[model samples]
Target: MVEEVERRKKEILKAIIHEHIFTAEPVGSRTLAKSYELGVSSATIRNEMSDLEELGYLEQPYTSAGRIPSDKAYRFYVDTLINDRENLNLELIKLLNNFNYERQGIQQIMSNMAKMLSSVTRYTSVVSEPQMKKSRIKQIQLIPVEGKRILIVLITNTGIVHNKIVKLKQDLNPRQLGYLNEYLFNNLKDKRIKGINNLVLQELEKRLIKRLDLSQEIIELVYKGLEMVSKEDDFKIYLGGTSYILEQPEFNDLDNLKKVLNILDHEEMLKDLLVTIPNKELEVMIGHENKIEEMKKCSLVFASYTVGDMASGKIGVIGPTRMEYSRVIASVNTVAELMGKIISELSG
Candidate 1:
């Protein structure tokens, strides 16, 4: 008898969640009794909903009204009810498999991934570049562009290329520049980009200045180029389907919409938020689970993707707390895994 009651409660909760996901409306007992084959009367379903609400799985937004699944209910559904082996959309899988990572760069790939996710999930998508702190330098070249300017080209193990222009106070001849390039390549080779900080640059400058009898101006130019390459902003973010958020009922309020727009505008904050999640596993932050104040009313589904062997990045979708968790979770996991595989292949 106890087992039967538990089964009935699960059925009712699943039906409510499914209805709420599509309609974005509160689910009533009558709706469940009519739509779902729960083998119970409206009164019995109402009593079960009351019990579920009292137990914290469902919440009534108003008096004498229908109920909506709370964060707890969503969590229960994701953990216990969702099928882990849900197949990826076949069309999306074909698109992913056909992607040409050789011709298209990583940035383009990330942008397309974000766009694909948004289009499929109908939610805002955010994809970040691989963190450079863990990526080792594969090559460094200093090419003289013109008088008093040089182009510093850096390639990382993850196949990311960074180029910067540095102005030198005094110009150095091609021979001197060649020696400097070789020195930089030898010093930075195999060193993590983030590990090359100002201190390291200063040390390199001091050594080059003393050993080669180079002018302080030329050494400072090299240091400046290295500094630009190692900055935290080396990692970039790409966003897609931002307009989709406006379609959700939760963002119908002007103030709520504005808050989300503001949060999206600040790319650094979004990058920080994605990285601070200690776990690289697929994670769902519902409602108040988000630390950012603007996201308290929203839900975030995110997962990490690897580049090469060491470097990794994050990809996620943001929508109202009433999001379809099963679909969002499956979509995020599939995209993240495909992205990691493509990146690994390209980097190799």
Candidate 2:
């Protein structure tokens, strides 16, 4: 009997959530009891809904006749109700296939994916180039600019390049820098440069020190500069539909709008938000489930796009907590996967 009551309550809750998502309005117990055919009276559904409200699953605003799903309820609905393994709709699959993305670069793919998501979900979308740490070195070009500075150009598999100057204590002539460039190209080109250490630097140091008067300090400086270059490569976040949030009822408060924009301005924080879960698969953060205080009023769904073994990136959508989880999750996952495939094809 307890199990039966629990199952019926779940059904009623799901119906309410579904209806609310569709209408963006509060759901009345009588409506669910009558239209959803819960096989129960309005009185009984009202009792159950009152209990759900008490349990933090539903909220009744201003003594209203209808109820809406609370953050906790949305969390429960998303976690237990969603079946991610289910194949996407055939129309959705066909739409994804029609993108003509085979030869497109990762940037265009991400931009297209964002636009697609916004069009379908009526929400803002942001796509980040795969995070830099997960990417491998595709090529390194050391260009001699002056006697003391060399422009170090690092290319990753994600079609992005990072350039920095390595300041040397000693002036290195073009010929010497040319030999150094050759050494870098021969040994380090196409190598994953993230795990470089003292021993690796020592080996290169021994070889180069004998050939030139370059100090260990200068060699280590170049190596450290490259490390900073790699971390900076993690993301170039492009945001769209930011104005859409302002149009939502939840963000009508000017202060909340300012807070949300302030949070988005911190790129590293956004990276942390996207990458903290550490899953290559799609993940959803709804309402209060987000650790950031400003984000508590919204929901975020994103996925990490891998670029070979060298790097991974993120693509995600941000909207009010009332977002359609199934649709957003599916679309975001599709975009991330397509972006990854495009990146791989580009580097290959």
Candidate 3:
């Protein structure tokens, strides 16, 4: 008898969560009994709902007898009820596979990811550019543009490309430029971007200082060019579908809508929120669980995508706490997984 009662309650709770997710309205026992085959009458479902309310899984809002899933209920649904029932959106996968991963750079890939995720999930998406300190240099090139100006191109193992223009104190002829380029390629190959500080540069300069062919001015210019490549700001946050949040009922209130908008506009805060995820697993932060005041009313579902095991970037969907958790979680996970593969291929 106890087992049967527990099964009935679970069904009732699941029905309420589903109903609320769709309509964004409180669910009543009559509705559940009519819409879902709970195999129990309205009175029985009402009793079960009361039991659930007492158990803190459901709450009666605005004196309405109908109940809505509380945060606890969402926690339960995400942790237990969702299980493995969610399936990846095959169409989304197909669309991603069709993308020209070879031609696009890291920034383009991240932008496309944000756009694709927002379009698919109908939620605002934010993606961070891969952190550079964690990546190693893959290749470097110094192309002479004119007399004293050279274009320095640096590629990281994680597929990020940095370009800088440096003006040298002296001009180099074809053979000298060729030798300098080859020398730089041979020395700085496979070095970490963060590890190339002044001390390291000085050490390299000292080793080559005695070489009659390479002038000190040229060596200093090369050092300056490398510094420029490694000196870019940490990373940027790419956001897409900001307008999607306006469609959610939870943001119907003007105050609530503004708060979310402000949070999104604050790039550093958003990046901090994403970077706090401890691992690559799918994470769900619902309601007050989010530490940021503006985001306390929202829910975030995000996952990290790795770039060849060196660094990881995050992609997330932000929506109201009454989000379709099952669908959002599945979509985020699918995108994160595919993104990791695409980034790996591009970087490799």
Candidate 4:
């Protein structure tokens, strides 16, 4: 249950959290009274802080006079205080524009994007490659090359084109190639990647071998071509600034630091860490909210980028619990939007 705070207490809580995030130190009531215009005396602010501590919103660290925000407070702040559509970061726009979308392949684009996100946010950034499994095959064409080699061209709805070259026992003429192209497209058009399976291949081969008088080598190569296009290499995580997380004071302890570093070392673990939420909303996982044991002290922010209305992949930021939610949120949202736009344009 979310506990409600009065307007005055809300102001005080906000002031303390903002101060704590800035200094990475437990916030003292005097600092809030002097720095923020809470319209309350230091004594009143101290009393409210005491109440907040009792309510599990704040905690005193090791007999320190000042108090720091608890995970609960961070969750509440993310839920209520931070605005998702905050003002744009102009520097981010300029940096994104620097990407040479026309020259770079998909791998380079995703790598550069990860580096850019980490640079702007000053936190570790993780990105996944664009997923093609959900994309429907728009067309497939077979073209004969030198000797008995045939090149397979596979086009999908997301603008991704895959090319595979296979050698056949017999060379195909123009008429034969034309017939095969039409046959493949008519059967496979608008079919999702999952639709291409062993059963589908068997059905295609049974018809093609009989109709075209195809050699056994040709039939096997045809199945291989289809398999190559439908194969998925999705959810490949790209990491930028793996060492940035080490800069946080929270990970200063050697034991704790080692654990966190191990978490970053595994791509599969990082994949589990950055889960994108539905409805295109920014997902923020505060300290202790994360399921990973080593990530309990960290905060993660994820934003999904779309390709033709489907969530293709995610862009994420990893930082200490003292993360600047407002700034990170803005950067992630802006970059995700730009990536989606570039991908759509590239596909065309």
Candidate 5:
């Protein structure tokens, strides 16, 4: 069983982690005594460090050298010692870019958000596309341009619009187009994409097949296009500042650097780094706690954002284990709240 750390030991542990995070080097007792106002001699601080090491909070990397904080030490520091992070808010807001959300699509907004996070935090940023589970069909329009060509616009209640152009073998007359529009609106309007199944598919097919005056081939093509736009993207992960993490001193090793880069290069694996829980606000995963083998040497800070009650998305920063917890945490919180508010307003 692990024993509780005393007040002085906790203070010493916090100091070591702070020094190591700043300099990326092993923290020795003499340096702590000289720099920090610990009110103790070097010998006393050294003794406390020894006890802290024995208790598994600190580890020595070399023989007769300074010690570094272990994963346990980092976890303790993040959970207990973090202070007011308001000083960095102004800088973060500027980097986040106060723009017109109503004019931008979700894709552009998310891409900009990823870049913003990386620029501010100097770490790799990953932002997931907003989930659209409850987004229902708002309206559908078919506009004719020229010979045998038409434009289809599918708008979702969540403010997502999809446009497609198709060439039909036969031109659709205005009367036929009006009838088809009414039929589509009566049957599919306000229907959730998730609820579209085989039963619904059979009914749509059966009714369309019975319409002998309409072109079956054109309806088939239209169905294909509509289905494509209605579904959600398969794990779309927007990545930014991927090379920034490589610049960290901890990723100096070539082998370790390659492993981390591989994870970032692939979306299937990167998607696992950001998972959104509906109501939970924020999460910080340190070292092995992240549960991904290639990412065990890194840390991930995640914040969940939602589009009103329809769907939720995620944004995060990936950096070395010795991360600036206070700044990163505050930044993620700020961005998540700002993003959720803008998206909700647009959707509403």
Candidate 6:
């Protein structure tokens, strides 16, 4: 009997979610019976709705009204109703084709795509640009310029090239800089060195200790090159339509608004939370499903975007659980797919 009631409870919850998604209104028992074609009486649905309310799936905003889904209920609905990538391939192709399909830089692609997503979904959209932290180094060049300065250029296999200038103890000639460049490439080529900073300098020092002439200057140049790389390796998050939330009644509370803004202000946390490397099509972390207090009141929809079939980028949407899952999830999936495509074309 408990299992039977539980199944019917899910059925009622599904009906409520569908109705609420379309109407954006709390679902009363009578409305559910008439609109959902549930083949159940309003009295029966009301009783089951009451039971579901007890189970923490539904809530009544006021004494005299119908039930709205709690965050818990929204989680269940997203987990069940949104697992499959429905009509995603066809819609994704359509949306991608609508774009010029040219090789726009990843940043431009994300910004425009985020705008499009925000326009369609009317929710806050965040697109993380393709980060090359995990990519391996392809080559390093030390070019001798004038006035005791040498330019260190590091190129990654993924077509990202970064350069920095370091003042040398002695202004080396082009021949010496060329030798150093070749040596660094011989040692560091194909190495994943985005995280390698001063520690890498120390290691290179130990390796080149025998060649006292090359050790100090090479390490200094490498240090400066790494500083440039670190600066470039930082994530870029483009957030569109934060103001859209102000229009929603739920964010009317000043305190809640502050919390949301704080979360948005810490763009690094957003990158860290959403840009993890996971083989997931869509990631939905519900209220309290997140690790932070600010996010406890909301939900995040994230998906990883790959660059050139190798490197991973991230794109997502953030909004209340009442967010239209089918539509927003579709938009997120489509944007993530395009982010990957754009990065692949640009990087290739």
Best by lDDT: 1
Question: In candidate 4, what are the lDDT values of residues 1-348, reduced to their tens digit?
Answer: 135347777889888888888889999989988999988799989998999999999998888779999999989998998787685567777887776789886667778899999988889998876665767888798888898898888877666677788988888878778888899899989888766789988998889888896687888897797787666653467888888877788888888788778878887666565542333547888889888888888888988888777777788798988888888999999888887888777776
> How much is the lDDT of residue 269 in candidate 2?
74
- Per-model CA lDDT versus the true structure: 0.85, 0.77, 0.83, 0.81, 0.78, 0.73
For candidate 3, the lDDT comes to 0.83
Cα displacement (angstroms), candidate 4, residue 11, comes to 1.3
Could you arrange the candidates by lDDT from highest to lowest?
A: 1, 3, 4, 5, 2, 6
Residue-level lDDT of model 6, residues 51-94, one tens digit each, is 89998999888876688988889889987755545644454456
Model 3 lDDT tens row, 195-278: 888898998888776753767887888788788677634577889899999899888899999988987888877766776565
Give the per-residue lDDT digits (tens) of candidate 2, residues 104-207: 76677777777776666678887887656656677877776766787888877667777888877777777877887788778776666566555876787778
Q: Looking at model 3, which ten-residue stretch has the lowest summed lDDT? A: 83-92
Collision pairs in model 4 = none
Better of 1 and 2 by TM-score: 1
Q: How close is candidate 5 to the true structure, as a TM-score?
A: 0.80
* Model 1, span 225-319: residue lDDT tens: 77787666578899999999989998999898988888898987787677655447588888888888888789999988877555367898999
**Deviation in Å, model 3, residue 312 alpha carbon:** 1.4
lDDT of candidate 3 at residue 48, scale 0 to 100: 94
TM-score of each prediction: 0.90, 0.89, 0.81, 0.80, 0.80, 0.81
- Which regions of candidate 6 fall more than 4 Å away from where they truly are? 1-5, 87-93, 101-103, 139-153, 160-176, 194-203, 206-221, 224-233, 275-279, 308-311
- Cα lDDT, model 5, residue 103: 75
Candidate 2 wrongly placed segments (more than 4 Å): 85-95, 146-148, 309-311
Q: Rank candidates, TM-score, best first.
A: 1, 2, 3, 6, 4, 5
lDDT, residue 331, candidate 6: 74
Pairs of residues at least 3 apart in sequence or in different chains that clash in candidate 5: none
lDDT of 5 by residue, 1-348 (tens): 134337778788889998998899999988999999988889988999999899899999888659998888888888988862644666677766666566788778888888888888889988886654456777888788797888878776656666778788898888878877778877888888678665886688679768737767888777766666665553367888998977899899988899899989888667655542223677888888877788888888888877765446788889998888888888888887777887778766
